[model samples]
Target: MSQGDEQRTAKVEPLRKARPCPECRRPSTRDNYPFCSDRCRNLDLSRWLKGSYAIPVADDESKADDDYRD
Candidate 1:
């Protein structure tokens, strides 16, 4: 194969860096990505299901006052 052909076959985009698992500080797997294993992934899911992880909702004073008047 010619050098030009080999160059054309090469990857055009930059490779992504491997991110550590959120639950455990370990290299992630293809199947259980973002988490190292099923156990770690399940634990995270349980937290969410049990309302352990919450997103804080800021109450807008002006909007609430106008829209939700009794």
Candidate 2:
């Protein structure tokens, strides 16, 4: 291969460093990323789909009622 072709085909490193998989706590893979494998990735998705992960909201019933009345 020519020098120009080599330069064009050279692999570029990711700007951010790889982090450990959130589900398995193993080194993440380039293919799966954020997760070590498809299993871990799907597990996380399953949790989200099943409502296992949720954002907490503070209950303010009085405030909500006031808004509706206004």
Candidate 3:
């Protein structure tokens, strides 16, 4: 391999480290990414669509008070 070839064939590292699937807890694949398979990916999506996942927000009492104008 010439110097030019070596330079051209540089090793490319993945931007993020592979992690276990959130559903099955299996090693993730390049195709499915964070999930091990399509099933796991779809399952996660279904959960989101079904409102199984949610972000909690604190109720602002101050804002509630502001809604009532004197």
Candidate 4:
């Protein structure tokens, strides 16, 4: 077999997981995994940049007590 034959046979499996896109719920591509397309990916990024998504934080009673002591 030629080197070309060996090269052709050697294929790399996709390491990225294939799942539904978070933004559009469409099948994800290898290039834009977790998102279906550039548009969807960009939209998600825009939302993040715009502070549309917020992380919920719980008020720690212990921290609050310490603040009052000082």
lDDT values for all models: 0.84, 0.92, 0.92, 0.89
Q: Lowest summed-lDDT stretch of 10 residues in model 1?
A: 11-20
Error of 3 at 26 (Å): 0.6
Model 1: how far is 16 from its true place, Å?
5.7
Identify the runs in model 1 with alpha carbons over 4 angstroms from their true place.
1-16, 59-70
Identify the runs in model 3 with alpha carbons over 4 angstroms from their true place: 3-10, 59-70
- The predicted structure with the larger TM-score, 3 or 4, is 4
Candidate 1 per-residue lDDT over residues 1-70, each given as its tens digit: 9999999999876255667899888988767887889999999999999999988865776876777786
What lDDT is obtained when candidate 4 is compared to the true structure?
Answer: 0.89
lDDT of 1 at 52: 100
Runs of candidate 4 with Cα error greater than 4 angstroms are 60-62, 65-70
TM-scores, all models, native as reference? 0.62, 0.72, 0.68, 0.70
lDDT of 3 by residue, 1-70 (tens): 9999999999999877989999999999999999999999999999999999999865887876777865
RMSD of 2: 2.8
For model 1 the TM-score comes to 0.62
Give every collision pair in model 1. none
Off by over 4 Å in 2: 5-11, 68-70
Order of the predicted models by TM-score, top scorer first? 2, 4, 3, 1
After superposition of all CA atoms, the RMSD between model 3 and the true structure is 3.4
What lDDT tens digits, residue by residue, belong to model 4 across residues 1-70? 9999999999878787679999889999878878889999999999999999999765777887887899
* Cα misplacement distance, residue 32 of candidate 3 (Å): 1.1
